[model samples]
Target: MGRDFEAADHSAALIEQVQEAIAARTTLRIRGADTKAALGRPIEGRTLDTRAHRGIVSYDPTELVVTARAGTTLAQLEAALDAAGQMLPCEPPAYGGQATVGGMVAAGLSGARRPWAGAVRDFVLGCRVVTGHGKHLRFGGEVMKNVAGYDVSRLLAGSFGSLGLITEVSLKVLPKPRAALDTALEMPAQDMPCKLRQWRDAGLPITGACHVDGILHLRLEGGEGSIRTAQAVLGGERGDGAFWVALREATLPFFNDRRALWRISAALSAPLAPLPGQALLDWGGAQRWLKTDASVETVREIAERLDGHATCFTAGVADEPFHPLPDGLLRIHRQLKAQLDPHGIFNPGRLYAAI
Candidate 1:
């Protein structure tokens, strides 16, 4: 039982790569397993693989915190947490279970429980990163605390590795719920959102909610009494709890289609709006995944009208996977990019071509 928990510190090696790229005026593509490769815009550069630096640095089950090197796979971290009966509340996806800890924070996509539990960024406590300047720096700490300046740690979340190389991260965790229940009710698609809102406002133990193919899928968490009470009130047939995992990992039959996929983030009550293909509602309509053959403009325009924005998950379907930012926001992103990776040596064009 003497497996090594101490990970080799490869920050020096990563920092060296950044320094070399900076001196040569070339770019560096920060990567961890490359599992989220298709999730962002393409960039050309020498790959800075983080997998060589892997291990759980420190874990405190009593404090509900775990810090691990970026190269450590989510499954690895989850195994440790599972042993302690704790979990990463964000429920980040690990497609084919190859997603690494760095990639999880970089991609920043969460599962159905995200609405109730919080997001990947929300659980991020701190991180150690190698900036474009070829310097190693640590931000935040093991515990949640006030950050006087930049919250660069959490900012790395969903950054697609454009910011810098995230070598390690400290994340807040939570004990598993005492009891959980999964159920599904057949209902009109349009009514699902409203009902979910009602339940949320009433403070039910509702943790996961989705409506796909006229079935409102639900997950209840908390004590046994609370789940049982909610289940009785909601009155739905028992559902396969594994369904949530499938959706989280993008393994559901709904995602098997070759059609381009659009992720629409809108208010919980946002309408499905017209789609070129079909839509699956998750997070109780806060998120809508559409399988469509429509043009990028059509998909984004629909999301805009709903006061939301759309991101294309299918590469080559859109020049920019993420929705375009306003001129001012774009400028700020460029500024931050310059400040961190002044030479633009880190994952150039990974987030946007303009940046």
Candidate 2:
């Protein structure tokens, strides 16, 4: 159960290596580095390092799509994208220098811009993956609107490498904004829901907005004239100053907790309840990062009541860190797992233990 993982430095080599390992009945704790290793249960297997599958396969700025080996670091990708005046709309967090493209899709960690732009899965056009039974298969393709069949590439996102080892990924990139400005206002915590609803209903095209402490920070982008118009329409609710992005990035004191980190995706109006420790609100009140000692059941019950779910972003052991599946859904998951990996040579019991 130690964090003893290895790296396969090349895309083709990693795929072949994974296939060979599966044929040999080798239990591999597949990983890019160790950034997201704490996400799932520490497997009782030797590590399969895919970090060696690095570098971009292709990048077409005119087409707004980039294909890169799964193990390419997010930092490297971002720098490349910046040079081309483009970025991943998903705004994935680097979370240390080790988080790779594969880990980002598997972990499904999107930043504040997620709601404004789209999720990681939304941009996944295609991928080449090595399945559990030592088979290399290509899912989807390089085209965006090619939904001619099941969207396997998108499904691979958030699958946590439990289904397959992603060798290469094709993602849709977005143009960088021409102008950007941030505004903060002193707003009451209780007024956040109403403010968010009003602002969203207004169609202001605000890039990001979040309430922390007693201040509400909002980000605006696009043409300078349009941003100015937005600021005028926003009225006296705007004040200059504060790094909302860093706070949204969860680098502030509120996120420095060393306890179990639970990410609760619930209604914007979900009443903030007291936990063992502090928490940070983001994504217009929908996403909450809590540092607490509350039992999974306790947190899950609260989320369930509010028509949402809670996942343990960081934790030790829990009964159910993710939202449990009903009988019907559980049956479907089992069927799919059987179809893709009958032997379960992949990350066994990743999303759930019984599976």
lDDT values for all models: 0.87, 0.75
lDDT per residue for candidate 2 within 1-355, as digits (tens), equals 1111332347567667677776787766778877876676667666778777778777888889888777888877887889889999887777655689888887777888888898899889889888876777889877767575558888888877777788888999989987766777788756777877787787666778776777777887788787777788775555453465465345777677677888889886677565445666778778877788787888888777767888886757465567787889888777777777776777777777766
Cα lDDT tens digits for candidate 1, 243-345: 8899888998999888998899987556766567888988888898999988888888888888888998888889999999999999999998889888888
Show the colliding residue pairs in model 1: none
Where in model 2 is the C-alpha error above 4 Å? 1-9, 146-149, 233-249, 268-277
TM-scores of the models, in the order given? 0.97, 0.90
> What would the C-alpha RMSD of candidate 1 be, to one decimal place?
1.5
Q: Which one wins on TM-score?
A: 1
Q: For this target, which candidate reaches the highest lDDT against the unseen true structure?
A: 1
Q: What clash pairs does model 2 have?
A: 6-49, 8-49, 8-52, 9-52, 10-52
